[model samples]
Structure formats: C-alpha cells, structure tokens
Target: MDRMPRWADVILIPLISLILAALLSALVILFIGESPIEAIKLMISGALGSTYGWGYTLYYATNFMFTGLAVSVAFHARMFNIGGEGQALLGGLGVAVVLVYIPWPHWTIALLAATASAAAFGAAWAALPAYLQARRGSHIVITTIMFNFIAAALLNWALVGPMKAPGQEPATVSFPEATNLPTLHDIFGIIGIDWSRAAPANVSLFVAIAACVAVWALIWRTRLGYEIRAFGYSEPAARYAGISPFKIIMVAMLISGGLAGCMAINNVQGEAERLVLNAAEGAGFIGIAVALMGRSHPLGVFLAALLFGFLYQGGAELALWMNIQRELIVVIQALVILFTGALDNMIRMPLEKIFLAARRKSPPPPGPDRKSTSAEAAE
Candidate 1:
C-alpha cells in the first residue's frame, strides 16, 4: 500500500508547494522594496479581472498545454525530450510552408493541413535523435539540446533565404486571408457574447484541449501505453516481458515531438498569421516546469498550464503598471518552478509523515463478521 493517498499525492502536495513558493516570493518582493501583497492583487486582477485578461491568459495557456503534454509523453517512457524548442521551430516552418505555398478554399481545411504538416515536421526532426539514443546509446538530452541550436540555424537560413518575405524582415509573408483562423472574440460574438477583439486567443484553444484528451487516452488506455510504462519501469524486466525498447523510444519521441509541433497552430497560424523568428517565445522550455509540476498527468498539466499562463499575463501587467523589471518577473516565475519542481520533496515528505501518523492514530475498522467490543456495544 502507498504511504499517502492518491489525492494527497496529486493535489495536497502541489498546493502546499505553491503556498510555500508564494511566501518566498513575498519575501523577495519585500527585499526589493515593493509590496508583495499589492503585487499579488495586481496579478490577480490583471490576469483574471476581465474578459480581456482571460483571453490573453488562455492564449498563453494553450501554448503551454501542447508543450507540457509533449514533455509528459516523453517522460512516461523515461526520456527527457528537451528538443521541444527545435521541434516547435520546425513545426512553424511546416506551417509557413503549407500556408504560404498552397491556396486553400477555407479556414477549416487549411487548419487541418497545417496541423498535419506541423506534426510531421516536428516528428521528422525528432526521429534522428530517437534513432541515436535507441541504437547508438547516445544520450537523448545532449542530442536534443544540440538539435535546438541546429534547428535555430536551419530556420535562420530558411527565413533569410527561400522563405523570406519580399522585405528585410526574416519572416514569411502573411498567410492568405482565406486561411485566417477565427479568434475567440469572433466565435463568442456568434453566440451573442461580447469578447475582446484584440485578444489573440482563438479556435486553436479547442484543439489544445482535444490534444490533452487524446494524450490521456493514449497514455493510460492503450496497449502501447502499457508497453511504454513497462519499459520505463525496468528495461530488463520489459525485455523479459517481450517489449521492444527501440520501438517504444521511437514511438514516444515521435508523439512527443508531434505534440510540441502542434503548438505552432496556435501561435503561428492562429495569432501571428505568419512564421516569425523566435516564434515559439520560450514556451518549449516552460513546458518542462509544467510537466514536472503536473506530475506528467494531463489533468495536472491543464491546471499547471493555467497557473503559468496567469503568471505570464500577470507579469506583463506588473511590468506595465507597477514599474517592476522584467527580470523580477522572471525571478518570481523561477521561484514557482523551483518550489513546484525542484523542491517537491520538501512538501511531499512532511505530508507523507503527517498522513502516516494520522493513519496510525486512527482506530482500526471493525470486521464484518467480528462482534463489537463491549465499549462500542454500550455506546
């Protein structure tokens, strides 16, 4: 039996960690001669106060959801695919290629084509690293990291050369008007709800949510997921059980890369309407923290993505109105990541002890067939 209940492991530990991180963040703000309480109020109001705030927060969250799910998929197979950055970059290239080169009759068809292209490109980029790791015993982490730099260089060359718009800017031209996606504002307007037209959140948000559901079904409800988990648990045991490590590694990384690539649909095809330099905006790295804090679970990833999204939108607000430096915002984000990811045990261990003590202190339940004690009977 487990020392702590499943709910405690999933919810309570993370909650406590977040609280502790908040306390530390408050101390940091005080040291910097700012009111932490006021800062928090601004964050809450800025990130969740109005429909406009929610639009931005959800937009950022959509990106995190894809990348976080990518990390979670790879993590299930005991692999750390840090190449989400490169994968996403290539995915953007794919989106640009499909949108710029092809003529589409409608947005729906274009969206589907671009999504397929992005996933394919991302998976192709990840294939080599997966091969090296599975066959040549090369480390996945090093190869993936190196691939990020390679992908950046390749994207730079493409953008400045063949894919460049007819100007100095190293970005693709705006996608055809027919391919433009409907924003959340537009969609909501159809339902007779007022929403901010300036917000970037769009139809792609539903796609991200769908991806989460797909990943959940893939990881926990399929035979392949069983093999991946089996391989992750112990290679020797998995081998004994006739599971192929090479196949597991390749499939997991492909899915991971594909998910990472799908993020392009939101940022590139949905918001920017063109592929730009540094289009991913560091969302790939933020995914690691999300996956870690979420315990590699889809539901957890969704909530963690929202929290990080709030931080991002809220941080922008702080910089605008509070005169807080961007670096300080980064520091606050790092503290949250630190407590939730690196310092997880700091919260979990104590909780486990508390639950264990409580379990011991409680009286044992009566057996179905056993008679009650005299004191119980009298009562």
Candidate 2:
C-alpha cells in the first residue's frame, strides 16, 4: 500500500491559522489607538448581544458556509477555483430571472424553480473553464479569474438594463413577496420581539449545514469523489488507474459552481430580501481563504467560515469601539490564509517521520542479494 498524508495532522493546520489570525487582529487594534482587549470585547458583545444578533450572525454564516464548502470541494480535487465569486453572481442572476418571469407561483414551487435555475446557471458558467482544463490544458487559475470578471460585467449590464426593476432607483429587480423566502419569525411563528431589534434568522442556515453533510458524504463515499482524488494525486496515475481526468474536471466544477450558486439563497432570498447586483459581497473569494485555512476538510471549513463570519458580523462594532478601519478584517483573513498555507507541510512533520520509520522496518524487494556474483568471480 502507498503512503498518504495523515488525516489528523491535516486537521491541525487551520487551528494554528486561526490563533495567528486572532493575534494579528489584536495587533491591528493596538495600531489604531485602542485597547485590544476592549475591541475584542465589543466584537463578542455585538455579535452575540442577544438572540437577535446571534440569528443575524447565523444568517451571514450560512452564505459563507456554502461558499467555503464549495471551494473546499474543488481543493480536495486538487483544483484551485477562483470563479466562485462569478458563479455565485450568475446564480444570483438566475434567481432574479426566475422571480421576474414566473407568474405568481406558490412559494414552494417558486423555491424549487429558483434553486434549480441557480444551480443550472452556475454549472453552465463554470463549464467553459472545466472544458478548457480538460481538453486544452488551461490553468484553472487563469480561466476562472477571467471568467469572474466576465460574470461580474455581464451581471452588472443585465441589472442596469434588461433585468432592471421598472421605475426603481436600485440596480435590481425585487422578487415578488410571495416568491421571497420566509423569515424565521414569519415561518416559525414564534414572534413578539421588537421588529427593529429582531431580524429574521434566515432558514438558509439549515440549508448550509445540510450542504456540509452532503459534501462529507460525497468526498468520503462516492465514486466521483474517488476519481477526483485520483486525479488530484497525479493525472498520469489517474489515467493508468482508468479514471478520466476530463470527466473529473466536469464533475468537480459542476458541484463547485452549483454550491456557489446555492450560497446566494442565503442572501438574495434570505438576507437581503431583494435581488441585488453585489449580493455575493466577496463571500466567494473569501471562501478560498477559508478553504485554505481549513486545509480543505469539510468540518474544518465549516468552523473556519463561522470564525470569519464572526469577524464580519462584528466588524462595525469593533471599528467604532477600537477606532480601526473595518477593512482590518480582510487583512486578518489574508493572514490566516498565508499562515495556513505556509504551515501545511510543517504540520505534517510528525506523521512524515512515523511513516518513514515504518517503511524502514518493512521488508525489501522480492529478490536475492547481489553479493553472490562478486563472490563467485573471486573464487
């Protein structure tokens, strides 16, 4: 049997990354003329102030969670997908188109239609890059990055022209109230909180959690995932093993792009309550950082996304109290990615030594020693 990187060591990489990110965040606070302790305190209080704040944090985390998992899935297949931002934007556009054209459909029907449309659009948007990687040997980084720009421009053009809401100031078409996702309070029917103070804890959180489980199953159990991992190891090896790299690319990009689109339901349908041009809010890009920090593990990415989600939802309160710019959170996210990527190999040191020692103790190749030839010549 061949050796593989130990699973446990893989889990520790993100834990170290997060500790470093927190320390860097504190340094940011000190630089901005505020007590690090005070600033952190404000972040905690604001993010968890009450049931309402917690709900909002969960809502934001839902989108991030989906994006992070999408990126992680691609990473597991040894592909770097940079177009999550665009895939998500295209997904958002699909929702807008469905809402505008559909004629007063029931909420359940609308939900299904919107979800299926978003997935189809996202998969289509990603398919071209997948094709290039499969047939033309194009680098995913270049293709996906270029595609992201194209998606953004196309989305903006559509929103400002053909998809524009009639007589509206914003560059968006609002979904009909009936087609919109139900708020936590409205659908849950456990109300009586102040409207201003309380927000609808978007149902998308559950969807995000469920997506994680699905990813875990896919990565650990499915034949498609097995082939993707084979390609990840080496293309030649995968070919020798009868796995098709081209097919793997298509499957990986489809799931990755679909998840990117699915992430928007958390925002366009649940958070923003309106179809907006910038609904992605860079969550797709940040998801790369999250996936890297988590070392592409499903649970690790989940926790990492929630941690960043904490920073995001708490940024304003921290900024005011700590006299720092909100953009500091971006810096912290970068630091996490850097440290995690840098330390990945180092984190494997212990397991590497163990495997090496085990190899040394094993038997050699199935052949007799060559010393007899030299002895016979001497005789």
Clashing pairs in 2: none
**lDDT (tens digit, per residue) of candidate 1 on 1-379:** 4577656767777777777777887787788888988888998999899889999999999999999999888888889999998999999999999999999999999999999999999999899999999999999999999999999999999999989999889999999999999999999999999999988999999999999999888877899977877777678999999999999999999999999999999999999999999899888888887887787888888998999889888888888888676466567567767887678778878888998899899953454333322111110
Q: Model 1 misses residue 85 by how many Å?
A: 1.4
- Candidate 2, residues 191-287: lDDT per residue as tens digits? 6654223664566777788888898778767887767766776779989999988888889988999988887777776666566777798889888
Error of 2 at 224 (Å): 1.3
Question: Native-vs-model 1 lDDT?
Answer: 0.86
Candidate 1 lands at a TM-score of: 0.93
Task: In angstroms, give how far residue 305 of model 1 lies from its true place.
Answer: 0.9
Off by over 4 Å in 1: 364-379
Which regions in candidate 2 have their CA more than 4 angstroms from the true location?
1-8, 167-170, 187-197, 346-379
- The ten-residue window of minimal lDDT in model 2 covers 370-379
Q: 198, model 2: CA deviation in Å?
A: 4.0
